[model samples]
Target: MPYNIPSGSQSNSSGVALARSQNWAFNPPSIDVISSLHILQAQPAAVTLSVSIRDMLASSLATTHSDFNLGITLVQDADALDLFALSSSTHTISNPILLDAAVLLSMQLEVAFVDPTILLEGRYSGYIRFSITATNNSTSIVEEVDLREYSLNLERTGSTTNLLTPRTVNMAYIQGGVSPVLDFDIIPAAASSGSLGYVLSHQGDTVVTLAGTSTSNPPFTLITGDGAVSGTLALDTTIWDSKSLGIHDTVINAIFPDWNVILGMDVNVAVFNAPGAIVAPDVLEFSTLVPDNPQEKFIDIFSTNGFTITAPPWILLSQSSGVDSARIGVMPIDVSNFIQGTYQGMVVITASGNIYEVEVIYQVNDQLETTIDLMDVNFTKDNLYLQVNGYDFNHFLQVESTIKTYDIAGTEFVTTDVVRVPFFNSSARYDVGEFIHESMRWIKDPQAAALGVLDPLSAPARGLYQKLGFVDFNLKVIDRRNQTVRFIRNLNGTKWAPGRSPFNDSNGYHFQNFNDAVARITTEGFGIINIFSKEASSLVLFKNNVEIDSFVLNGGDLPSSRLLIYGGNYLPGDIIKAQINYGTPAIPQLLEKFFVVYPKTDYSCHFLFRTSYNTLEILQCTGKILGFVEYSRQSNTVLKNGVDIINHIQTNRVDPLKVNTGFIPEDQRYMLDVFKRSLAVWLVVPQYTQPIPVSIESTELSHSDNDRFLHAYDCEFKINRDIDEQIYLF
Candidate 1:
C-alpha cells in the first residue's frame, strides 16, 4: 500500500495551487470558482494561482505540468491586465508524478498571476483558464482540451477573508441518554474542492463517546457530490450526569488538496434530571369580567417525561381530565353567578407526584345607572350635643368638613385631594368686644371651666370652640357637593362622653388620617353611652386600626356582643375606650381588647365616622383624601411574624351609599316583590379575611304607577385593602 499524498503544492512565488485527486472515480473533473484573490504591497512577489488536470478513465495515465497551459487575467471595470503575459504558462511540481492508483496521476500549475507592486486600491476580478492534454508513457496522446474558464474575484482595499475562513457548527445541547446530530458548513476564503475533518476534546474528566460516523480519516477529503461538502456528526450523551457532564470543543479543519483551514465549535451535554412538569402563566389574573359572561383563558402545561398531569377542579379542562406528555391547554370556568366583587383562588397542577400552585384573581364590575356620589347621611343626636355652662346659657359648637377631589372611571369614583374646611365654632354672645375675647379663650379646652370645679370662672375656657367665634348657637358643615349638615344640641344632655376627669382628661387624642378611606358603620337612637343592650350590642370593631367591621350584622343577625371589664375599671364612658369583642362568643373568655375600634378618641377634634360617640363632633367626618382610589388588584408582601414569606393579591373597596335607581308601575308592586325573591341572595361571610359581596335592598316611599321604588346595591363601596389568601383547596 502506498501512502497518499496531495497532488498540488504552494508555489514559491507567493501564490496558491490545487490539484484534483487521481482517484477520478471518487471525484468529478470540473473547475471550482476562485472565490477570493488578494494582492498586497507587503507581499514579496507576484501571486500565482493554479489548477490541476488528470485522466479520469485511465487511472495509470502519466501527467506533467508541461502538458497544460495555466492562463490568468486580472480585470477591473473595463480594463484588463494580462497576468500570465502569455496564454501557455506552467508551474513545477515539487513531488515526482507516477501514473498509478498510489499516485494522483495529476499535475499542478501556478502562474505569476498578479503584480503586487502594480495592485491598486480597488476591486479586481480574474478568470482561471485551464488547457490540458493527457498521455501514456508510450507517448500516444489520449486526451486533449481547450481552455475552460471560472471566475476569480480579488480586492485590495476593503476587508478581505483571505486571512480567515468562516466555519461554524450548529450549537448542540443534547440531554443525557439522547443523541444529537450536528451539521456544519465552511465558507472558504479561497475556493477549492476539498473534504473536512475534526479534532474533538473534552473539558474536564468527563469522557464522551462518539459513534455512527462515516468519516474515515481526520484529514478527510470531501466528496463534493454536487460541489458542496456536507456531512452529519452523531454525539452520544448517555454518560453525562450531575457530577460528570461533558462540554466538548471541536476544531474542524478543511483538508484542501493543498492547504488546510481550521475552525472551532462548542458543545454542551445537558444533564437529564427527574420527571416533572412546568406550566406557563405562573399567575392567572382576570380583570373586570362581566358576570354570566362566558370568558376563558388558556394555560399550557408541559412535562419532561410522558407523565400524566392532574388539573385542579376549578380549572375547566376541554377534555375529560388530565393530559400526558404533550403541552395541553386548560381554561377556567366562567363566573356563572351575577355577584359583583373580587373572586380569588388558585389553579393547582399535579404532575409526577409533584404539586404546583398558581394564583388566580378575578373581579366582576357592576353596571351602574348613575356616576355621581350619593350621600347616605346619618345624624347621631348625641353627637350634636353642645353644653351651656354659666355664660348666658348659650351652648358652644364646632364643625369640620372635608371637601375632596374624586377620579371617576365608569361608575367607580376614587376620592383624592382632600381639603378640610378650617375648624368652625358657633355660640351666642351679647357684647361684641367681650364675645371675641371669650371665644378665643374656649379653644384650649371647652371643659376648662368645668374642669376646675373649685373656681370655675378662674379656669379660662380656651379651646378650639372659642377660636372660630361661633356667633350663632347652631353650627353647620357643607361638603364639596353642597350637602349641608346641621348640628343641634342634645337637650337631654345624655353626653356619650359621660365620665370627664379634670385631673387626667379621658378626652380622645387625634391621629392622622389613613392612606385610604375605609368602611365605617353608624347607627342612631339604638342605645346611649355605656349601654349594652341588643340594639347597641352589635358594634363595629377594629384591629391595628385598619380592619374595621364592614358589616354591622352577619347573616341577618347581629354579631355576639357582651360587656365585660376589658383593660381597666368600668368608667362611665369606658365602653367608648374599651375594645368591643365581635363574633359569637360561646363562653365569653375574659381576654384583653382583641378588636380595637377605629376613630379611637380622635372624633372630638379630627374628622371621624358618624357612629362614633362624641358630643361636640359628628362621627361621620370624612378624612383627608390622599390619592386616587386604585380598583386594580394589589400584590401584598405576606409576612409571618417579622420575616417576609410570600406575595399575596389584595383588593380594595369603600362603603356604599343608598340611591334610588328607578320606579316600577302601580300594577307591578306585587310583581316586584315576587321578583326580589327569585333573585340571588347575597351573603357577607369573610373568607380569608376578604370582604364578602352583599346586597341590601329596600323599597322607598316614592311610587310610580302605584309601584314603590327599590334601592339596591352599594356601588360606592370599596373592597378590603388586603384580600390576598389562597382560597383554592387542592
Candidate 2:
C-alpha cells in the first residue's frame, strides 16, 4: 500500500528509516574509476543516477562513452519498514554494474515511475546523459525506456571518444598499516551499521575490484566515537596482511545491509611506506663513443628512515634526498665538452643511520667501429614501416620530444622507458609516427582554454590532433651483444605532426599526403601544396622560365622545419623551376638547382626516379608524323592523265594525349651507375590514361641536374595503345 505523506502529526516508528528519508546525497560507486551524479530525484523517494566512469586500460586510441542512469527508491511506508527490513528498491537498470573482471556495483540510482505525481517525469535537466558501461559488455543492456519518450532536448559533441580515459587522477596517498584508520565524508553520515555494506580488494587503481561481501570488522559507523554517525573505519585487517611494498587498495560496495539493492560505494587506496633497503649499484658508470652524446644510469632509493645522497662535485644526481620508492639518475656534468678521457667521482648515501658509498666512473671512449647505421632516408609518408638496419641490434628505445610547455613553441619534452623496448641483441624498430602520436596524448601544459570553453588540448583531451604541435623522434639502441652495454642513437627521424594523419575522421577532410615538397606530408594521396617547410632552407622559384622569388635561409642551424615550398604560381605546364639548398653544418657542402616541372602535351608520359644525386629533369617530345601519296610535285608529274597534271597529298597523324612525369633528378654517372643498388625508379605521374596504356620504354633510368648533368640513359614512358588507334586525322 502507498504510504501517506508525513506531516507534523504523522511520524515513522523506526529512526533509521526516517533518517534515510531526510538525508539527500548518496555514497559514490564501489570502484574509484566510476563516479555517480544525481540526475533525477523526487526527494526521499527516488533519484535518477548518471554514472560517470574513468577507464585507463587501453592499448590504442578509441572513441566511445559509457552507460545509463540507475534508479533507487527508499522504503517510505511505515508498514513496510515495520513488516520487512527493506531499505530501498531497485527499479529499471536494476542489475548490478560489473566494473571490471571482478568488481560489480549493485543498486546506486533510479528514476522511478510510481504512484507519486512528482516522479521527475522529464530527463536530466543539465548536460546530456546516456546508459552504457565504458567497459565492453558481456551482455547487451536492458533498455527499459526510449530516451525520446520523455521529449527532452540533448546535444552531444561529436562522439564521446577518449573523453574519460588516458587520464591520471591526483589522489591522496595514505601509508598502508595494520588496523589502519579510515575516515569518509559520507553524506548524512550513514546513520546505522544496518544502513551500509561493502566489498574489498587487495589492489587499488585496477579499480582494484570484483564483487561479493567482505566480513572485515571495518566500522563505517562511529568508529571515532565523537559523533553517533562518525564516518570512521579502523580496518582491523589482521587477516589481510597488507603491509608491504606498493599500493594496497580496497573496493567496498555500500549497500542496505540485507537488501540486494546497493545504495552507494566506497574505494580507498593505502600506499606502501617503502620498507627500508639499500637498492643501489656498487658503482655508477657512464661511457659513450659519440661526441656530445648523452649517457644515463640510475640508482633506486627507498628508505623508511628517510635517505640523503651526496655526490662528488663533477657528478650530477637527479635528487639529493628522498624517502620512498624512486630512481635517482646519475649523469656526467659535461662529457661532450670534455676531451676523450676517463673521469671518476663518488656518491655517498645515508639511510636508517647507515652510510654507503658508490664509486662513480665516467669515460669518453674512442669512437667505436660499428656497422650499425641510421638510414638517411627523408620521407613525407606517415607510419610506413621504417627501420634502423645494421648488424647486431636487439632492442630500441625511441625517445619522442616536443616544444617546452612554457616556451613560445608551446609543447613539452618527454622520455620513454628503456626496458619497454628490451634489447637482447639490438634489432629493434619502432613506428616513428605511432610514438610521436602517443606522446601528445598527455596533457602536461597548464595553459587555460579561451573563454569558458575548455582548451581542446586541456583536460579531457579528445581527437587525434593534439594541442601540442610536433615531435622530434630520437631513438636510442642499446646493443648488449659482447657482454657489455653500448648505446647507439638514430637521431635522423624528423617526422612532423606526430599526432596527425592524412585524413581526420572528426574534421572530415584530406590533410597530409606523400608530396616530396610537402616535407612533413605522410598520409597517402592528401597533401598541402605551395606550403612553406617547417625547417630553414633555401629555395628559388620560377614560372615559365621567368624568375619569381628566391629565399636564401640560413643562420638557424637546427632543423626548425621552417622551410617553405612555393613554385611562383605553379600551374600545369608553367615551367615551375626550383633550386633547393639545405644541409647541416655537420654535413658536406652543397648548393644545387633541383629540377623543373615541364609542360604537358599530347603523346606525353612521366617516370619516377629516386637516387642520391642532387639534380632533377623532365624529358618531353612533340610534333607530327606524315605519310605522302606516291607521285606529287617532288616526283615528276607522273601518274597524271591526258589534259592536266595531277599532284599527290600528304597525310598528318595526330599524337595521343598522355600524362607523364613532370620532373626528375639523377647523377652524372647515374646512366652507367649500375653498381649502385640504392637507385629507385617508378612511373610516377598521370598513370590513368585508359585507351592508351602508359609504359616505360627503357628500364635503365638516369637524370641530369644543374650540378650533375647526364643527358643519356633516359627512361621515357612510351604509351602503348590498349586498342588500336581508330583515327589520326590531320
Candidate 3:
C-alpha cells in the first residue's frame, strides 16, 4: 500500500492513503479531517500498477447514518440524482469518463503515464485540484474527500472468507457449569475446528493471538470441546469445578491444515469454585446494631458433600458438624472476661473441605450510643423541667431589655442591651445562686439598692441581675457535644412563660392598673384543662376559703379566666386559685394558677424578677403612714454616708416616706433580704398623680438588725427621681 502524502505528517497535510484490506465502497471517508493518516505510515507503501478502492476500507475511518448519506451528503436539487436508486456493491457506472492528454500534461510527470489504476478510475464526478510544490519536490494533490477515500464499500468488521467474530463472554464470572454458549458467526458452516487457550493469572483478557497465549497461556486442560460449532457451540465446563480460572481463547483454523487464515475469538471466563458446601450470605451483621448484644443469629449451610464448621474459641457454633446441610446458631461466648470496653472478634465457617469465610465482626465499648432525648422542655410550676436522659447540659438564656443608665447630670437614656447566660442552671425549688452568671446576678451593691430598686436577696439571679424593662427572654439548652439543642421561646409574643416562676409565689403580672385582667392560656399545645372536658366541674375557681365559680368547658371553649381583684371581686390577702384537671391520669392532674389581692397601693414597690417560682414581687406594708422606703443612688461602687443620712433623709428636702413597718421581732422585716435581692424594681404611685419613681429609704435593716426593731421600725422612703415635678418612666 502506498500513501501519496504531499507534505507535513499531520493527516490534514495534503495526502490520500489507503489500507489494502479496507473495503468501504459507499460510506463517508471520515476525512479524518485526517480520518486516520496513521494507517498510511503503518505499512510501507509500494507503488502497484493497480489497487482497488475496496482495500482502503481496512484502516481509514468512516461513518454512516441509517439513511441515504454516502461518502458525502447529496442534497436534493432539480439536477441532483437520487443516490439510493443506484446499486452500491456491484453496479458499474453507465457512462465512461475520458481525460484529455492535456490533463496528463498538468498531472505529475513522476506518475507513469501507462498506470492501469488511472485507467480503472474512469470518472471525474467532481472538481479536483493537484499541484507540485517546488520547495520540497513533493506532489500536492487535492481531490474530493468523498470520492477518493469514502466511496469504497464499508464491510463493518468482517469478510466472506473471514469469520465474523463470535460473541465471547470475557472476564465472565461463572459459578458451576452455568455460562453463556459461544455464538460464533461462522463464515462457512462446515469443516472448522479450534484450540482453546487460557491464562488463570490475567485479571481481564480479550486479546487472542497464535503465540505464547497459554499460561497467560494457562491451558484450559479440564474444559473439553471444540472452540465453536455451526451455531450454538457450548464448551463442556462441567469439569471446570477446580479452582482453574482465566480467559479462554479460540483460534479458528480450517479442518484442512492448508487453510492458513489466522482468525480467532476470546471469551474472558473468571471461573468461580463450583457449588459444593456453601453459606448463602457471605457476611452477617448481627446484634442490636450495638457493639455488644446477647442476641444469637443463625446461618444455614448447604452441601452435597457433608461439611465441617470451625471457628475461633470465643465464637460458639451450635452445630459444628452436619450431614448434607444444617442450620447453625452463633454467638460470642466468654465476653465476661473482657473489661468494660469494646472487644472485636471475627468468625468463619469451613464448609465441605473448602474454607468459606463469612467474615462477621462485633466490637463493644464506650464509644457509641443513642440520639437526642429532648422530648420537650417546659416550666411546670416553678422548675424548668426537661425530659432528657443521661446527658449533662446547661441552659442558655438570651435576654433583651431596656437598660437605664444616668449620666453624672442624672440625664438618663434608655437603650436596649442583650444579656446572656450560656450555662444558666437557675432553680427555684433549690438555691443555685452559686451557678448564676456573675455579670447579671445580683450582688449586694448599694448603687442598685439606692436607686429605688430594692434587694432581690430572697433570690439573687432573677431575670437580669437587678435590671428591668426586661421584656425579651429568648433561650436554649445545649449539651456538651454542642450537637443537641432544646429551646423555649416567647409564650404570647409578649411574655416568656418558661422564664417566669412567679406562679408559686404571690407574684403575677404588673397589671399596669387594669381593674381586671385576663390571663389567657398562652403556650400552644399546653392548656390548663382539656377544653373538650364534658364533666360538670372541670375547672374550679377558689376565693380565699370558698369556691366562687366553676366552668364546664366543651370544645371551642376558651381555657381562660378573668381575675377581678380590684372591682371588689376580692379583698387584700385573698388567695384566688384557678385549678384545672389536666394530664393523662384518670383522676387528672391538678394544675393551678393563682392571684393574690393586695390593697390598692398609695405607693407601691414592684420587683421585676424570676426564679423557679416567682417572676415579680409587689410589697406594701399595712403599718400606718409607712409605704416602701426610697434612697438616692450614687455612681460609686462604695458609698460612704452617715447613719443619720442613711436612716433619716430630711423631709424639708424630699423626705423619704417614713412608713411604720409592722415587724417580725426577728424573722419578718418586710422580707428586706428579698427587697435587697430583686432583679429589677420600680416604685410607683398607683394614683399616677406623680410619674416620678421613688426608692425605699433607710438601709437600716440588715442581717444583724433582725432584733433591732422593737414592735415596729418606721420605714422611710425617698424620691429616687430627684426632679421636683413628677415624671412617669425611669
Largest TM-score belongs to which candidate?
2
Give the true-structure RMSD of model 3.
36.1
**Residue 104 shift from truth in candidate 3, angstroms:** 99
Per-residue CA lDDT of model 1 for 484-533, tens digit only, reads 33222211211112122111111111111111122232211011122111
Candidate 3: stretches off by over 4 Å: 1-275, 286-293, 365-505, 510-730
Greater TM-score among 2 and 3 belongs to: 2
The local lDDT score (0 to 100) that residue 602 gets in candidate 1 is 19
What's the TM-score of each model vs. the native? 0.17, 0.22, 0.19
Candidate 1 Cα deviation (angstroms), residue 514: 20
Off by over 4 Å in 1: 1-175, 179-272, 276-289, 292-302, 309-314, 318-330, 336-338, 341-350, 353-730
lDDT of 3 by residue, 1-730 (tens): 1121111100111111111122222122111111111111222122111212321122232221111111312122122123112222222223221211111211111111111111111111111111111111121222222132111111111223424344333323244645444433444322334633211111212222222222223332212123332433333344344446543344433221122223344443445454455464566543321123345666666554557777788778887876545557787666655544434455566655777776655443321121111111111112222222211113333333322322111222233323322331112121111112121222113233222132222111121122222122233333324534443443212212222212222221111111113232111101121121212235677776578777653321111122222213445666666666644456665656555655554323222221212223334433445433323343222212112233434333333455544443542332444454443333432332222334554545322343573344455555554434221220
When sorted by TM-score, best at the front, the candidate numbers are: 2, 3, 1
